[model samples]
Target: MVSPKTRRVLVIMPAWNEGATVGTTVTEVMNLNEGYDVLVVDDGSKDATAKVAAAAGATVLRLPFNMGVGGAMRTGFKYADRKGYDAVIQVDADGQHDPRDIATVLGGLETADIAIGARFADKGDYKVSGPRQWAMVFLAAVISRLARTKLTDVTSGFRAGNKRAIAQYLDHYPAEYLGDTIDSLVVAIKSGCRVTQIPVAMRPRQGGTPSHNPAKSAIYLLRSVFALLFAVTRSRSKIAVQEGTL
Candidate 1:
């Protein structure tokens, strides 16, 4: 376990067109008094998301083009690695994820290399679609079965990783349909990392529609399932290669 004196945390907010909510998110996180250095990776937002984040006291990293969430996250992870922070926490710019929950993730990080916020662990915090919720549960079960490790929530974006996990991810960003939530978890498991889940509070977005439209949500589910199958079929040699390099 790392002592508070020894731990240096960097909070990375990968945001795009979240100008309405980023300022409040930043304020809440700053009020947490967690001694975190915050970075808001502006994912090519046409709005004043960058300006809002900056005004709210977060360092901003702007991407030239609008890369997806995966790209924005990778950029923040790379910066976290370069800056030599002991750990990095990835939080949403939208007001759904709570900043006060950062401590729980950090506490979990003591025993696990990666600690993810599992919404299903505690009921009633979120009101997701029945089908989508069931899909996540089924996917988590399959991932647990394949990886031989129990994971309650496989796709929740609120997560924190120790320096080791950060280094591996920075060394190689997963590219095969990496934007989807489940595939990223699969890649982390394939790279031989310890993952643990903790219950965290979440709310519906304070503004704007969900990034996943109906058609895209369906496609995401199908592709995520296929990703699990692909990860399962890889040879031991391939897994070893991935482990050694990634």
Candidate 2:
């Protein structure tokens, strides 16, 4: 087991205009006494996201403008690397990610460079329909084969990464559509990062409007296929991880 006092674990929460729930989410995590250093990257929020997060006891990093989840997460990784953190866990600011399971997800890093919290691993009531579900299934199957492991939710944003994974992400994390989750994983796996999944239940988002819609879900499959193609075809980039670090 990784001792909270020994390993520096930074929980990065990417938020966009989530003033209503960011405080509560941060508070819950802070109360966990898990020795987690919470960092909330305010992705150019127009509202008081930065203020709320800071007030909730998170180290708030306010981006100049909105840069989606991909951009926000990349920034977080860079911060972690600069600060010499042992691990980085990407948690949603919308409260869909449960703070109780943060340790379980972090524990997976003991066996793998990247640990994803899977919602559909017979542990959560979360369900998706239409083309989005099909796209997720197809992507998961293909990625599972590539990673040589079965992953039920490859698109899950509730994921944690060790030092190696952070270095890899800094080298290849993308900001395009679906690139943050799908494309990011493909690059990490190809770069020799071992990945594993931890079953976790997803909670309803406490605040903020749902980002997905019927129109978006309708085109999810087509775009997802294209994303996969582009990710694999991109030129490979590798980074050197420090000795004795994951």
Candidate 3:
């Protein structure tokens, strides 16, 4: 158990035009405990996302322009590292992930370097579309086969990681969609860091239209799939090298 004097958790929210929902998300996360520091990475939100987040008692990090989700998250990691947080939790600004699940991840951290909240852990609460379901399955299968581990939801954004994981990630993180998950998966596996997944309920967006670019969904899927495949392959090669088998 972490001592009260050294226990510090940072909740990082990568928000883009989520002024309507950012406040609620920040408040819920902050209400969990007093030691949790909330940081909202506003990616050039056209609305008042940063202001609302600050008003809700969250430390707001404003990106001058839209840098996409991954970029915003990387910025959050930087702040987490700079402030010397013991652990950092990645959360969505869409209000889909529950802040209450933070305890699950924190508890799991005792046995793992990183703990991610998986919506598919129970299978009953998952309500995504069929296409997305298939996509996630395909990705999971590929990850399991390559990473040599069973991971139900490797792409989940709701995750908690220690200071070492955060520092390593900020040093060599990717900057695109699904980049956070990919980085965490590959880095944790290659570095021999234990990663655990816990069941968490996710709800549909309570406010604001999704920022997903409909025109790029197909392209993004194809690109991200290939990117993950490449990362998996590269990570495997590194493992082989470390084992001196290559």
Per-residue CA lDDT of candidate 3, range 65-152, in tens? 9998778888998898889888888889989988877877676677776787888887447665544566677777776665566778
Clashes of each: 0, 0, 0
Candidate 1 per-residue lDDT, tens place, 1-246, comes to 567567999999999999999999999999988789999999999999999999999999999878877788889888998888998888899988888888887777877778888887864467567556667777889888756767878878898998777866675554456333666666667667678888887887878557877776666657777777765554333433555633
Instruction: List lDDT for all candidates, in order.
Output: 0.79, 0.92, 0.77
TM-score per model over all chains: 0.89, 0.95, 0.87
lDDT of 2 at 76: 97
The Cα error of candidate 2 at residue 35, in Å, is: 0.7
Per-residue CA lDDT of model 2 for 1-246, tens digit only, reads 455459999999999999999999999999999889999999999999999999999999999999999999999999999999999998899999999999999989989999999998999899999898999999999999989999989999999998889889988899998999999999888778899999999999997888889999999999999999998887655563343334
TM-score of 3: 0.87
Best by TM-score: 2
Clashes of 3: 0
- After superposing all C-alphas onto the true structure, candidate 2 shows an RMSD in angstroms of 2.0
The candidate, 2 or 3, that scores higher on TM-score is 2
Total clashes in model 1, counting residue pairs 3 or more apart in sequence or in different chains = 0
Residue 4, candidate 2: C-alpha displacement in angstroms: 6.0
- The parts of candidate 1 lying over 4 Å away from their true place are 175-180, 233-246
